[model samples]
Target: MTPRKGERPPVPEPLPAPVVDAHTHLDACGAKDAADVSTMLDRAESAGVDRVITVADDLASARWAAEASTWDSRVFAAVAIHPTRTAEFTDADKAEIERLAQQPRVVAVGETGLDYYWDYSPPAAQHEAFRWHIDLAKRVGKPLMIHDRDAHADILKVLTEEGAPETVVFHCFSGDLEFAKACVERGFVLSFAGPVTFRNAAPLREAAAFTPADQLLVETDAPFLTPHPFRGRPNEPYCAAYTLRDLAALRGDDVAELASAVSGTADRVFRLRTVTSDLPNGEGLR
Candidate 1:
């Protein structure tokens, strides 16, 4: 069956091996409820994108993502207030997030970080909220997934000053080779999205190239950033396969090899134990 009118991009071919979508927003991607989530996961699984970390950019979505993870064994959640909404981040928001952060299904503490591109909130507020998130991540002992958009320098400074959590991921990394190298030097993971596959994204492609195998990840960030041929259309978790395949092609590595590598990295970073559950629910294949 073809995707409906709102869902413009139909499912593409399955990947050579299974992988994980390290960052995405189920609500933003048009999944209204648990049933919609299952449908989205079905499409993703069909394309060999076996598991996903559905992220939240606000308190309501964070609540939704936390609950959504419980709907399926394959879905996990990351909860946080977005940089663009820092001004709105309040005591109530922090309290709710604190409660949500403790949920077993919630994996990382993020989609948090600075976004200088959009000034929806004052810079001072954004910094304050970022500090709060960093502390929350450390308290919860979960990875911190960052959303750096045109604020790499301040991002580095803030993380350095606050002392980053044990694990940090640069979600939808949109940096040049130098920025990429700087991130890599600090032991941060760079998660590539649809932009890496664009015809003109030579710099993003270059960063994807020299990135360490174990420190790389893939995502759709969809209902947005759809890959290459599917750019300008609605993206879904299934579309991550396109980005992964494109990365494999760019690096001249075997598709299956790259898939396995990223999958393992995602498993550790998100600590989504079900990631390797492809074997069986019980003690089947280790």
Candidate 2:
């Protein structure tokens, strides 16, 4: 069923413990300035999502994401040229992305990888750009977050060919049991989003259940993929709390236990730290 446009999902009850949103898009969610960022994170914090990593899809958003990370201590950023937007990638663009990748507040290089579901960019162009982003992640010593949408095999293939970064994350992971095994075997982090709660996602549930707690993460991918019962509605970082509850129920694990595992994994993988204290008089990132 399609939710009416502009229909926002209700904020869910707080989790038993705090959890980080491994991925979200604050710019797309209508956050224009520090106040907007603060208000958005305040809702998320109230729902037990105390932190988040806002990911960028292109250069403009990448710049915005890096600056947004400074707007609030609860936020971190990941910058990359998404595969679908790589058709016209240029040297200057590459340089800028590399620069952003090195920023202290930018925790990862991603929302990168193949997206065969869309024809917005040709496969060859996407392949070339994906390789470049893979190398950038390695060079910067940061985790690589992937966006595999119907290109799982090629995504794996390229990572193998390019030599993945020390830490890798399959954001909004969309694979089955066997693919999940492949990622787990290689020690790749699989970040589950709202789709695992969908009624038609049994295979996804199987994959989620099979993922070791240490290799697992949860996200909202906000402004999209709102969890079931609230599917088709607008999503935000707070909705990550709802996804966590459903994931725990689906995996038959204790919510607090899973939340702890997820939180620990996020801290370790992203090398996250308390940055709000770094802001001058708590004035936010400059």
Each model's TM-score, in the order given? 0.93, 0.96
| Per-residue lDDT of candidate 2, residues 85-164 (tens digit) | 98899999999999988888899999889999999999999999999999999998999999999999999999999898
- List of clashing residue pairs for candidate 1: none
True-vs-predicted CA distance for residue 93, candidate 1, Å? 1.0
State in Å the error of residue 278, model 2: 7.8
Model 1 regions lying over 4 Å from their true place: 1-7, 274-286
How much does candidate 2 score in TM-score? 0.96
The most accurate candidate by TM-score is: 2
Error of 2 at 229 (Å): 0.8
Provide backbone clash counts, one per model.
Answer: 0, 1
Task: List the pairs of residues colliding in candidate 2.
Answer: 70-285
Instruction: Judge candidate 1 at residue 186 and give its lDDT.
Output: 88
